[model samples]
Target: MMITSRNTAKAALFLILTFFSAASLWLLLEAEFLAITLILIYVGAVMVLFMFVIKMLDTDQSTLRAQFTRYLPLGIFVSIIVIAQIVLVLNAGQFDIAMTGIPEKHDASYSNITAIAEQLYTLYVYPFELAAILLLIAIIAAITLVHRNESRSKKQNISEQINVQAKDRMRIVSIKPKSAKESK
Candidate 1:
């Protein structure tokens, strides 16, 4: 649905559905933490961001619909091929428990989150830190790209403000007061 949707908002909605489905699969695998994280990160934060971007873009729906119609046949063909491949792989009988053994159950004290953190901070720490730095740079680049310095917009000059004197902004006007309306 997401691939076929012409409307960006609809596509985002479909993506949210996909995220939820993935979270559901995680739950089926008894990975509650992963399921919640997926929902919170992808569905909550990312989907909201996507929706805001879609609204801000205000894309021409007519053009999107036209393009969708143009490439729909190709999309359908690719989708069919993908589905066929998945079916063939599933029917290959290599995924049975006999072939892939049963998963070992951990003790009651075992914590997947702790184990994941250990692995992440141990084996993958450098890559994780690199990814964080890259994300930070990307965020800074995005902010810089969107920061417009328009001449018409007011901007504070700290140096000028600090150097300004009261006299520069204020003037005293002298006016003679009337003597009780000339003693009227």
Candidate 2:
């Protein structure tokens, strides 16, 4: 259904519906929190973001159709590579439920969020910090890439910016008051 949709809005609607279905499945599995989180994150936030991005794109159907054939070969190659990886992984028995050990049932007093937080903050602290630093570096690199040097920039000068006064931007002309008889 999503693949055949030519309209971006329709595609987004399909994606939102898919998220809703997955959330419903999570609820059926008795993970109320997971279902709610899925709905809130994907349907509420991500779907709205997708809509905003699609609207901002401001693309015409003709332009999209024109590029479709141009990238078709690359898309097909990527799809084939993805399918091959899936087949290899499936054949490797990594995802076999029978081979995997049964999960231990949690005690009624145990909180899922607390356990996750403990693992993340204690056991995985270094790795977590490394990931954070990597993300920070990525952000800085992106900023650097977008930051034009003073020579390339046409922005206003800081000196000029600070020295500006309201009087410079606005002119208040003084005029003598005229009587109604003089005006006539």
Please tell me which predicted candidate would have the highest lDDT against the true structure.
1
TM-score per prediction, in order, is 0.65, 0.66
TM-score result, candidate 2: 0.66
Candidate 2 lDDT over residue span 144-166, tens digit each: 88894757777788999899999
lDDT by residue (1-184, candidate 1, tens digit) is 9978877788899999999999998776666779999999999999899898888996986777678788989999999999999999988999888898876776678777887788899999999999999999999999877676666667799999999999999998998887997968
**Residue 96 displacement (Å), model 1:** 4.6
Which runs in model 1 stand beyond 4 Å of their true positions?
1-10, 73-99, 147-174, 177-184
Check candidate 1 and list the clashing pairs.
Answer: none
Query: Residue 12 lDDT in model 1?
Result: 93
